[model samples]
Target: FHIELPMSLSDLVRLCGFRAAASPIHCRASSPPHSLPPAPVDGLDESLLADDLGAMELELRHRDAYLRSLGSPSAETVARSTLVTDSQVDQIMASEGPLDRLKDLYALNEDNEPSYELASVMLVSMATFTYLNVRYTVQERRLAGVSFEERNKLTVFASKQQASRRKMDYITMRALRLGLKRSASSLIFAPLFLGGAQCISAVRGRSSPLDFLPSGIAAGACVRGAHGLQPMLGGAFLGGFLGAVVGTVVYGIQMYCGLTYEEMRRYRLTERSERDARLMAKLSAAREQA
Candidate 1:
């Protein structure tokens, strides 16, 4: 639960209860509860029940899946329920006038050892940042979905976010374009570049501001190692530098905007609170099923 205190933004506001994910995604729709219908035949009623018994077996097979969707998980069930959001750059490649919600889904063979969890997260981050870019451009172009406030306090907040995203997106698209212009070796390096990008995004999406030097160094080292370069120091250094540059840009945005990723996340609490309220209302509408 988030608390509240006096503040200029909202005099009674305090932040808590929000958790940032390392990054990942997926889920499914809910189903109605099933029940056994009464048998309507005479002597055949016993036969019908025998058939019902068979139906029961089928239901039992999926019992765990049904229960798990309602919230709890059975021992055999995978603990997977999460949503990964898009960033400003992701928004540009993807949405609204002159903008689109660009997305690319990667197929994990499940045969290789690279963690699928991390892949899923990276995909979500890419998607999110693209969206942010689109949103920003739309606003700048005075395109649709740009809500102008009377006092426009929220306008400034939205503007800053959009501006920050635009700057970030500019750098990424520049890198991508550069890659396309280069030879096959550079093309092959794109994936390694992506991992470096992810390292920045994973930290950027969180509540706290991140230092880029660490991510740059780590991604650079990993890339160098994966490429089997002896000494490896050069690649690592370059990777670290790039990673830090990305991280530093985002850090500056956080400072200038006076809102950490966490504060921006709070803008979401109102939506969450409403969702919880709606959920409780539905829960009170029904009883437990067999």
Candidate 2:
């Protein structure tokens, strides 16, 4: 399959030109040198990170000092002051004796609203106990084997049942009524407490006692215009009592359930730690893929 044909240099040059024209240059140098596009630096400088941490610590210290000057400590300062670490919290929660943890639970910050569920449970328990005690008393009378007339002379089981039912109903109703009362008191007194605190704080910051003149005038007008001192004081006392009862109920339930402040703190920390670990894992995987 050889057919030899002699070609001139001009023909060869023309062939090369045709091929060059047909296909455009595809080399990197043909276009601009696309220097690896600038990538974001993921690694932070150690010195800069350290400086940021130091600044945060200083700010926290300042905040702690300011809060201390006001006769209050920040939550972090309080936690640090207690000298309770995570391990200690865990140990307290895991302690064998209920009474052992009661102290810590009592000391826990419980600034929460009263739980209706707990109150209802308590009411039910009291009702049950009352019913049982009454039933036991009636049984001890030996009225069961007596004749109808004799039974009638005694407190009958049916009457006993009815009384127990009534007592239970009364207990439940009282619990619900008290819960409603407490909630109403909280709604009324919460604003008053906040306003009073603000006024006191304002008065404290000022030199003259009369700095609270405006608030005093407003409050005096309110007290005078409304039912006078007696009714107001009575209502305040009732509301305070109800609120205290509600708070005590909630506190008792928390103590029963072993949900101490330290336990709560520990749970929160564990959750945060778990979340941070997961986030770190995701970041590491992403970095590896990159």
lDDT of each: 0.45, 0.47
Candidate 1's residue-wise lDDT over 151-258, tens digit each? 343435456778557555655554444433332233233344554444344344443334456555655565466556763677778866775676677667766885
Candidate 2 ranges with C-alpha deviation above 4 Å: 1-85, 88-226
Q: Return the lDDT, model 1, position 213.
A: 60
Q: Which ten residues in a row have the lowest lDDT in candidate 1?
A: 18-27
C-alpha RMSD (angstroms) for model 1:
29.9
Candidates in order, TM-scores: namely 0.30, 0.26
Number of the top TM-score candidate: 1
lDDT at residue 37 of model 2 (Cα atoms): 22
Off by over 4 Å in 1: 1-210, 226-231, 255-259, 268-270, 282-290
